[model samples]
Target: MGNWKLEVGRMAMYMSFPVVLFHYFNQPTYFEEWVTKTKRNIFPPENPQDKEAIQQLIKDMRTKQIQQFEGE
Candidate 1:
């Protein structure tokens, strides 16, 4: 648009802007806490009781299936 010097400066700014942003935001210290909090929110901590109940349900289903096979 302007002189050669101005065109080179504009090109440098366009290329360097994303490089600078990527460098800043990609640092672990910049985003680790947010990532951890987001993960916890998406997957709440498991409860011992819930784990036990799931295991018990699976056991009961297995036993029931075994009995059904035996009857057949």
Candidate 2:
């Protein structure tokens, strides 16, 4: 009975390995979509404050890109 239980546990682990790997491999895309959806739901950019913050973020990003390009 003990051996049977061990065998069953081993089989379960083996069966779950591929599923675990698939989930791990697909985690990044899943997390990205989740974050985007959550952010959109939580902090919409309709207000003036949100719009200014977004614009400032964009300006900072553009500045960094220009600096990098000039350096390269």
Candidate 3:
């Protein structure tokens, strides 16, 4: 009877360990929240000139490439 009780206790502990681990692992930890908040605060705001500058640079590069191809 004592061995049976010990076995049951061990089994209960084994089953509960997974539940405890899952509870902790599934929840967001402090470091995760800190990193998320830090990233949100550190991200750069979109600039109005960013798109225009990118488009103009691409156009200029294409034009330069075309000129080089024609020269060749």
Candidate 4:
């Protein structure tokens, strides 16, 4: 019975971990900062042409995000 209880407690803790992680990582400031950093890391602009493309992509993403939140 003690072993069963320990197993159940471990299972419960493991189940709750994803919920805690989701809550922590989904906070807007953290999520946005992570996204910005990831984008910069993955798509560093090289030249003027690349910079222009990046700017347009940023503009489009922001506009879409605004519309999505406004709709919500």
Candidate 5:
């Protein structure tokens, strides 16, 4: 009876370990909120140079898309 109880305890310990590890490893450590906030704050800049840089970036992206569409 003691051995059976010990075996049950060990089995429970083993089963619960994986569950604890799964929760510990799979739990969300989120970053998207702060990253999005940082991105939003950077744009529509007060500096003229920064605004021009953003405009050029958009133009370049549009040009790439147009080239891709023509290629296809």
Candidate 6:
């Protein structure tokens, strides 16, 4: 069997291995681009045409609703 020092060293290694990995991997610079790219892929930038179309659709719905209430 090993001495106390050897046992302590083993325990320290077990505990610190994950801590060291977390410290290095949690840095934003390491994965910020990756996260941003994934976000862009999931939700691409909105286009002007898409915005205009959405506004027009909303306006049409509102107008139709007003007309229905007025006609009733």
Top-TM-score candidate index: 6
Q: How displaced is residue 50 in candidate 4, in Å?
A: 20
lDDT of 4 by residue, 1-72 (tens): 579889999999999999999999788986797889999999886898888999999999999999999999
Q: For model 2, state the Cα shift of residue 62 in Å.
A: 0.3
Overlapping backbone residue pairs in candidate 6 total 0
* True-structure lDDT of candidate 5: 0.86
Q: By the lDDT metric, which is better: model 2 or model 4?
A: 4
TM-score of 3: 0.57
Weakest 10 consecutive residues, lDDT, candidate 2?
25-34
Error of 5 at 19 (Å): 0.7
How well does model 2 score by local distance difference test? 0.91
User: Which ranges of candidate 1 are over 4 A from the true structure?
Assistant: 1-11
Q: What RMSD does each model have against the real structure? A: 2.3, 10.9, 3.7, 15.4, 8.8, 1.3
Q: Write the per-residue lDDT of candidate 3 for residues 1-72, one digit (tens) a residue.
A: 578889999999999999998888777663688778888889866677997899999999999999999999
Q: What is the clash count for each candidate, in the order shown?
A: 0, 0, 0, 0, 0, 0
Candidate 2 — which residues are off by over 4 angstroms? 1-45
Error of 1 at 58 (Å): 0.8
Relative to the unseen true structure, what is the C-alpha lDDT of residue 37 in candidate 3, on a scale of 0 to 100? 81
Task: For candidate 5, write residues 1-72 as lDDT tens digits.
Answer: 578889999999999999998888665566567667788888644888888999999999999999999999
User: Candidates 3 and 4: which is better by TM-score?
Assistant: 3
Candidate 6 or 1, higher TM-score: 6
Report the C-alpha displacement of residue 70, candidate 4, in angstroms. Answer: 47
Runs in model 6 lying further than 4 Å from the true structure = none
Root-mean-square deviation of candidate 6: 1.3
* lDDT to native, each model: 0.97, 0.91, 0.88, 0.92, 0.86, 0.99
Worst 10 residues of 6 by lDDT: 22-31
Best by lDDT: 6
